[model samples]
Target chain A: MADNETLDAKIEALTAEELARGLDIFRQKLGAAGALWLQTCVHCGLCAESCHYFLTDHEPQSIPAHKLEQVASAFRGRYTLVGRLAPALTGARPFDRDLVRAWVDAAFGRCSTCGRCSLNCTTGVNVPAVMRAARATLTEMGLIPADLQQVVTTALETGNNMAITREDWLDTVQWIEEETQGAVNDPAARIPVDKHGANILFTVNPREPKFFPLGMQASATVFYAAGEDWTVASEGWDLTNYGLFSGNNAEGGAIARNLLDSMDRLGCRTLVIGECGHGFASARWEAAEWLRERPGFRIISFLELMEDYFRQGRLKVDPSRLTDRVTLHDPCNTVRQGGISEPQRSILRRCVTDFVEMTPNRAENFCCGGGGGQLAMAQYRDRRLQAGGVKAEQIRATGARVVVAPCHNCIDQLMELNREYKLGVVIKTVAEIVADALVLPTITPPAGEDHDVTS
Target chain B: MGDAGLRLGVAICAVLAAVALLLQVVRTRSFGTRPPMAEAQGSALRGILYAFGPGMAPSAKESTRTHPVVYALGVGYHLGIFTAFGVLVWSMRDAAAGSALPPAPVRQVALVLTALGMIGGISLLVRRARGPLLRAISIPDDYLANLLTTAFIALAGLRLLAGSLERALLVGAMLLLLYIPLGKIRHCLFFFPARWNLGRHYGRRGTFPLRH
Candidate 1:
C-alpha cells in the first residue's frame, strides 16, 4: 500500500511538467482552422444528440462539445488574456493529473473521431480536429492506453501492428493463392508478390494475412477476374497505420514513407489499399499530408478499382447467386471522410441481387463503434459495444440477411454485433461479395501478362 | 441633446470591439494559412456555396431537423441581433446630424423584430439552463453573453416603442459591443470564416455539398 501510494505521488508530481509540455504541443496544433473551431463553438449543446456515445450513455461528458472543451479550455488558459488573468470567467482550468486522465479517456476512448458531430455543428466547428488536438496532447504526455501504444510500437518495430513475420505472411499468402486457384477452377490464378512494374501494388489489412486470409483471397480473385496485373510487396505490405489512431504524426509519416518507398522499389503504377476503411482512407489521403509529398502514383481503394472494372465491363459477376437482402454499413473514414461512398454502393448494386441501405446511410451513417482505434483499445470495449447499439438498430431495421461493409474494422465489429444482438446476418466485405458472385470470362489472360481489354 | 454623449460612447465601444476583433482575425488567419497537403478531389467553390447556402438549411442538418423549433428560435434570435445593429447605426446617424427619427413605420418594424429576438434569446437561455447536457457544457460566459445580448435587444425594442428610452438602449448596446471580444458572444466575428474553412476542408475532401 505504501508503494502504491508512492507511485501515485510520482505520477501526480509528473503532471505539472507533462502538462506544460502538453500545452505547448496543443498550442502548436491550434492552427488557424483549429483556432476558429475552438473560438466559434457557442456551447449550444445541439451536437449532444449527434454523438453516438451521448446517444447510448446519455452522459453529459459524452457530449461532443464538452469533449472539445477539454482541449479548448486548455488553450484558453495558455493563450487568451482573459483566460490567463481570470481563468474562471472563461472556464479555463490549469492542467493536473485528474484533468489529463479525464481528457485521455474522453478524447481517445469515448470518442471515435468519426467526424459525425461536425456535420451538425451550427457554427461549423470541426469537432474531430479539436478532439485530435486532445489526443495529440495526450500522446505527447505519454497517456495513450497501453493497447494503443502496443499497436503503434509493433507497427514501428515490425512494419505491422500484429507483428506477423515475413515467413508467416508468405505462407498465408501462398496458401490463399492455392485456395483461390482451386475455388476459381483456374490453376493459373496467383497472388503475385514483388512483381516489377505491375499495374497495381496492393496492400491489405494485416488482419487479412494474420487471421482472415480468405478476405485477401476474395480481393485477389476479383483482380484475376478483371485480368489486372497486381503484386503485393514482401516489405511494407501492411498499409494500416496505428499512428493515425494514436495521433502520432511521426509514426504516421514513417508509415507513409515506408509504403511510398516500397511502391517506388517495386515500380508499381497504382497503390491499391485493401478492404480496411481507416487504413485505406488515411494512407490514400491523409498520409500524404503527414509526409508532405505527392506520392507520384495514384492511390485508389479496392472498391474504386472494382467499380472501374465494372464500369469498363471487364469483370462480370452473377448477382443471382447473392439472393439474400444485403445492407451496407458505410465506414465513417472511407465514406464520410474519404469520399468513396458511391463506388461501394455501385459495386454492391451489381454484386448483390437484393441490396438495401441502412437508414441515414452514406456519409451520415453511424460508426460501427470500432473506429478511432477503439477495437484495439481493450479498456473501452464495453463503451464501444454500447455505442455500436446505434448501428445495430440501423442494421436491424434494414432486415438485411447479409451486411456488406467495405471496411475490415467495421466487418469485425459488425460480426460481434451480429452475435450479441442475434441479428442472424452474415458479414462480408465488398470484395468477398464480388468474389462470391464473380463470373470468369471464357478467354483467360496468360500467366504473366498485363491485362489488355478490347471490350 | 445630451444623447450625444451616449452616441459617442457607442462609437468608441464599437471602435474598440472592431480593433480587438481585427487582432483576433489576424491571429487566426496567420495560423490557418498553411496549404493543405492533400490533393483536392472536388470544387472548393461548390463547397463554400453549400456551406453557406443549403448547408445552413435546417433540413440539411440532423440537429436542426430534430429540433426545428429550437433551430427556428435560434435563427430568429440572430436575425433580431443583426436588425438591432442596423437600428444602432440608423439611430447614431440621426443623432450625428441632429435629424429626426426614421418614419414611425420603420421604427415599428424594428421594435417588433427586436422584441421577437429578445424572446428567442431568453428562451434559449432558459433551455440551456434546464437541460443537463447544456448545463454541463455551458460556462459562465455562455450565460453572461446570452443574457447581455438578449437584454440589449429588449432595450432596443423598448427604445423603439418609446423614444425616451434611447439613452438606456444605447448604454445597453455599448456594454454588449465592448464585451464582444472578451466573451463567447464573439462567435459573431468568427462564424463566417469558421464555416468557410469548414466548407473548404470538407469541399477538398469531396465531403461537402453533402450528397444524399
Candidate 2:
C-alpha cells in the first residue's frame, strides 16, 4: 500500500493520516467491555494461581488480577464515585497520559493479549477487552514497538513484512521443493506460489526464509504428500504481523489487509497460516476482526490440516516414527481464542504414542511466556524463563522427553523452558511430528494427484 | 466511661463493628478476583458499591446450575445485609419507639446477625489464607483487612462479652463508617452496582450476561 522507508525514513515520513489512524485504535476500543469492565468484581482471588507468569515469577505483583487492576483502577476513577473519593485506597487512580501510556505498553506491548487471563478470571472480566482497551490507547498514544511497527510499515509498503523480493520467495519455494524432493522420493512435489483460485492461500512468516527454511520444506512435503492445492501470494503475502503483538492495532489491521486483499484477489477458498504462533494468532483472531470483516479466506493451522487428513483417513501415522515421549503445548491463542482443543488433541493422539497431558491443558494451558513479542524481545529472556517456570514444572511432571508445540513461539519458549528448568524436553512443531510420523519413501500421493497445481 | 460500661459497650460494639467489617471484606472478596494490575475501573463511588455488592444480583452469564448455591446464598446474605443496612441507615433515633424507621432491636439484630454471617465469610477468608490451596493468595491486604476489621469487631465483641457503655463504641462505629467512604472498605458501598453493571454490560455483549 506504500513504499519502503528505512527506520529513519519512516520516522521522517510519518503523516497525520498514520498518526490519526494509529491513535484511533485506542478510542474505538474503549466502551469495549464499556467500562462494565469497570464494574464487575468480587475480588475473590480465584485467578491468582491460574497464570504461569504470576506463578513462575512469584511476584505477588504479577498476579493476573493485580495487573488487571491498573485498568480497573483507571476505569473507576475516570467514571465512578468511589474511585473519585478514595482513588488510591480503592486502587483507582485518575488516568493521565503517562498512566495511559504505561497501560498501553503493559497490556498491548508487554502482555501477550493472549486471553489466557480472561479464561481464568472468575468474574469474567474479559481481560482481553481490558487489553483491547489498552491496545486502543496505545494505538492512540503513538507507542507501537519499533520491531513490529517496522514490520507493519514494511508490509503496508512492500506488500510483505520481510520485504522478501518476489525472486527470493520463488527461489525459497523452489529451494524447499528441491530439498523435499531430495530428502523424500516425491519427484512430483510442487511448491505452488501465486496460483489463483486455489482452496488454500498458504502464507508464512518471512522468518522461514530468513532463519528457519526447514519448516517451509517440511510443510511443502506434507502438502505435497496430502495432494492439496494451496497457493502463496506473489505479493502482499507473509502472514506474520508482529504489529498485532506489539499493540499497534492499525498496523496489525494493515498487515492483515495486505494478506487478505491478496487472498481475495486470487479468490482462494482458505488461508492456511503456516506455523508461526503469534502471526497465526494475530491474523486469525485479531487482524481479521480489525479489518472490519472476516478474512478473505478461512484461516486454518497446519495442525488443523494434519488433523483433517488423519480424521479423513487420507494420511496414516505409523506411530513408530516418533520414539520420544511427546506432549502437546496448545498455543494460548489457538486453544483459548480459537477453541481448537479438540483438533489439537486429535492430532497428538494419532501421532505420539506417549502423549502426556499437562494439568491445565487445552484453553487453560500456560503461555510460552514468549508469546506477544516476549520472545521477540531478546532483552526479556530472564523474565521469560522465570515466567515460564510453571510450564517447565508441568512438563517435568509429565515426564515427557519432548514438547510438540504447534506454534512457533511456543516452540521457542519451550526450548528455553527445557534449558532453564533442565527438563530435557525437546521442542518441535506438529509438522516435525508429521515429518517423523510419515514413513513412506516419500509421502504417498492419493490416486490421480501427481500433477502440480503450479503446472 | 465506667469500666463496666466501657468494657461492655466496647466489647459489644467492637464485635458488631468488627464483624460487620470482617463480613464486608469477605463479601467484597467474592466479587470475582484480582487479575494482575487490572482492577475494576468504575468511578470510585461505583467501585465502592461493587465492593459492597448490590443486594443479590445475578449476572447474565451466571448459569442457574453452577450458581444455584451462590444465588441462594447471595439472596439470603446480601438481601439480609441490604435490609439491615437500610434499617440502620434509616432508623436513627435514640429511642426504641417513635423512630422514623424500624427500631435498633430489629436493626441491631439484623446488624449483629449480619455481622455473624460476615464473620462466617471472614472465617472462610481466613481459611483461604491458611489452606494450602489458597496460601499463596494470602496477600497483605487479604489477611490484613479481615484481621483489622475483626479486631474492631472483637473489641465490640469483647464489650458484648463483658457487657459494657455504648458511646465510645458508638464513636468507634462512627469512625469506621467514615472510613468506609475512603478505605479499601469503600467497596462496602460500591460493589453491588459496580458488579451488576459489569455483569449486565458483558451480558449484553453476548460474552457474559448482565447480572440482575
- Residue-by-residue lDDT tens digits, candidate 1, A393-439: 99999999999988888888998888888899999899999999988
As a whole number from 0 to 100, the lDDT of residue A132 in candidate 1 is 77
Assess every candidate by TM-score: 0.95, 0.69
How close to the true structure is residue B118 of candidate 1, measured as C-alpha lDDT? 86
lDDT for each residue of candidate 2 in A22-99, tens digit (9 for 90 to 100):
334433555423344444544555555666666665555465565666666666665445567756445666555445
Clashes of 2: 97
**Quality of candidate 2's docking, in CAPRI categories?**
incorrect
lDDT of each: 0.85, 0.59
TM-score, prediction 2: 0.69
RMSD, one per candidate, in order: 3.8, 10.3
Error of 1 at A72 (Å): 1.3
| Best by the lDDT measure | 1
